[model samples]
Target: MKSSARSRLADRNGPLIPNIDIARPRPYLPRLLKHLFHPVFAFALICAVGCNPNGESASGKRKKERQKTAVVEQRDISFSISVAGEIGPAEQVSVRPEVNGRISELPVDIGDKVKSGDLLFALDDKDLQIELETRRTEIASANLEIRKAKQELDVADQEVELDLRRDSITRAKLEQQKAKDDHARNKILFDDELISKEVMQSVESAYELAKNAVLQAERNLQLSQERFRKAKERARTNYELATNAVLKAQRNLELTQDRLSETRIVAPFDCTVLTRSISAVGQAVSGSGGFNSGTEVMTIANLNEMIIDAHVNQADITRLSADMEVDVAVEAVIGLTVKGRVERIAPKATVRSGIKGFGARILLISVDARIQPGMTAKISIPVVSAENALSVPLAAVFTEQEGRYVYVVVDGVYEQRAVEVGVSDYRFAEILSGLNAGETVSLEMPGEDAEVKEMPAEKDKGKRG
Candidate 1:
């Protein structure tokens, strides 16, 4: 009778309670009776043996039915490449002096905003000014020397005229003609027996002496002209040397003035001073000399426009192009997202830290004050995208020998169907054809024996649930 009753209870409750020998007599029969009759224990036993088939609880069946799957839906899907980069000003400059000098008057400091041509600093110009004065004095002295040489040249020219007049060549010629006439008259008389031979000889001697005087006069004139020519050449040379000296002095003066102007440095453009290398007003700085370029005086930048430098994986670099729009997020400023455009992409690939990638520059469409140089930025560049496309979880799609496919549930059975897939991100894949919205697809591969059915036509796609 006890066995029959225990079997009956097991049959009614579905075997959740263990077989206990409750029909046997025990010293703690009263305690056992009280515990077995408690409401909590009875309710727990009923809950354990829930009203479901095969002695399994309702929750067990629900859990078993919860296999990973996704429902196809019409949604926006895109493929993007995300990368980490750094933000910087589009135009930055390291300011330096053009000439070596001491900072005499520094007007701009770090963080100062300046307009184009505003004075940034000044160097001491006292020495240059003094040198410039000396150059002017030299030029004046050269002018005086030029004037003195001109006077000497005029005196030498006047001496040439004076010496020519003093030679008396005309007077010597007249005296020679008179002596020849007298000698001719005396010779005719001596030959005709009208004068003595001694007188004729004396007249001949006088004529010869007159001819010698004419020759002497011509020699004197030639010597004086040559001396005058030499003197004029010397004077003209002296004048040329003085003029050259003045030119040299003028050139030196111009150089000194140029250096003086350089003492005042001005801003090249409208910008903000980002750094100041000099601490005080008189720090010395080097200029471009030999192999040394110069001592950097300060740094400035135009903060209105900014750029992000990012390295993209070589596999994804081929998809990037100039002027392509992208999205940017600043790490320093939380929740700050802005639009950017691709400015350039490196032609060659570079390896950094054992990873090969291409360097790309992205220009910010708009810059925020909070975005600063050296700030970390995240860039999302879209390679491909689709709007309101029929899509499913990426895991739901699979590729096999027959091309890409998916296991879609139809009539409570997984049916393999070939699919035309488009762009896919990390989460969803765009279905170009072969699948319909409202259909369910298995996330994991179904059994090999699952029938591969012919997919619907393009017009009939997204019609079946």
Candidate 2:
């Protein structure tokens, strides 16, 4: 029993020896844990202190220091106004027909340069010539009729004069016979005293018959004189009527000739032909409606004086004036800029698509060979400009209830600045006052102060260590 009791104690002691070896290594583990945990605990304490609301961290302090050293820049600014315009000739003359007629011969073609009084086209003159010849024949017939009437009047006057002379001689002979018979009758009366009284009565009857014949001859002479006067008057009236008829016919012939001359169209001034409407030589054209109502057989325009007709919006019209300088660019001839001036402005606004715009005419100060009529152009009008002026980005200027203002960084703090503005374009604004060159300005608004802090490089390295 003693031996068994000793063996049992040895077995319990042997297991206890292996457990002690493991326990010895466990003490070293506790020591390592203590060494690691002390530094972690200290780091936690430091983080808690720095993150507290009462105290600022190292990163926060560095951000404030950098803000104080920020800088800004000043730039020279320019302002310009741009508009789309069209290039055209300064003068445009529309060639229209005065009297309508068929285009018989078109002498000029498109792009032909012509001078004043140059023949442009001709109309058919066959009908006009025929009418003129007919009028001349009528005039000749009227003249022949007038000559016949005058000759008849002259014959009638000569006949009346001869009849007057014969009637006068007959009257004188009848008077002498009447005197002799009376005297003879008186002598017979004395002798008849012894004879019959019937013989004396016969002599007295012969004397009375002679007296009546003389009175009739005198009346015939007076009638001849009156007939001669009437014939002469009629002749004079016929001659006047015939002369007027001849004159009228002559006038009609002259008028037809003039119209025939007008058939040849001519240019009124120096110009270039823009178009030609007729080419076929045998094309039939109506005499009355061939080229009226602006149906141009050809078009000519003076290109030396070229002008641009631009439509300016009503909002910008108020700022325009005569003689203002402008730069024009034509789309047809690219990379060319022509100088021009505001020549005229329309008195009223024109509404197109419910937008109101006014017509403005721009005259080219100098002629350009590249500029042509109907070409589109882009116009730049300089409203105002300043050289070497204080300026900033347009985005930097912000409006408030007072006026324009900008945020300027001063001494690590953003301060609001009131600035006077002059002019602005798409990119920049001219700062008239309240800002200087080389000053720092913030492009973005600052958030909370804590949000702007940056992590320190030393802290990140220490954490890695």
Best by TM-score: 1
lDDT of every model, 2 decimals: 0.78, 0.65
Candidate 1 — worst ten consecutive residues by lDDT sum? 9-18
Which candidate number has the best lDDT? Answer: 1
* TM-score against truth, every candidate: 0.73, 0.62
Per-residue lDDT tens digits of candidate 1, residues 369-409? 88888899999877567788888876676655445667788
Task: Kindly report which residue stretches of model 2 are placed more than 4 angstroms away from their true locations once superposed.
Answer: 1-104, 137-233, 288-295, 320-327, 339-344, 378-390, 407-416, 426-428, 437-465
lDDT of 1: 0.78
Predicted structure 2: clash tally: 5
What's the true lDDT of residue 223 in model 1?
A: 78
lDDT of 2: 0.65
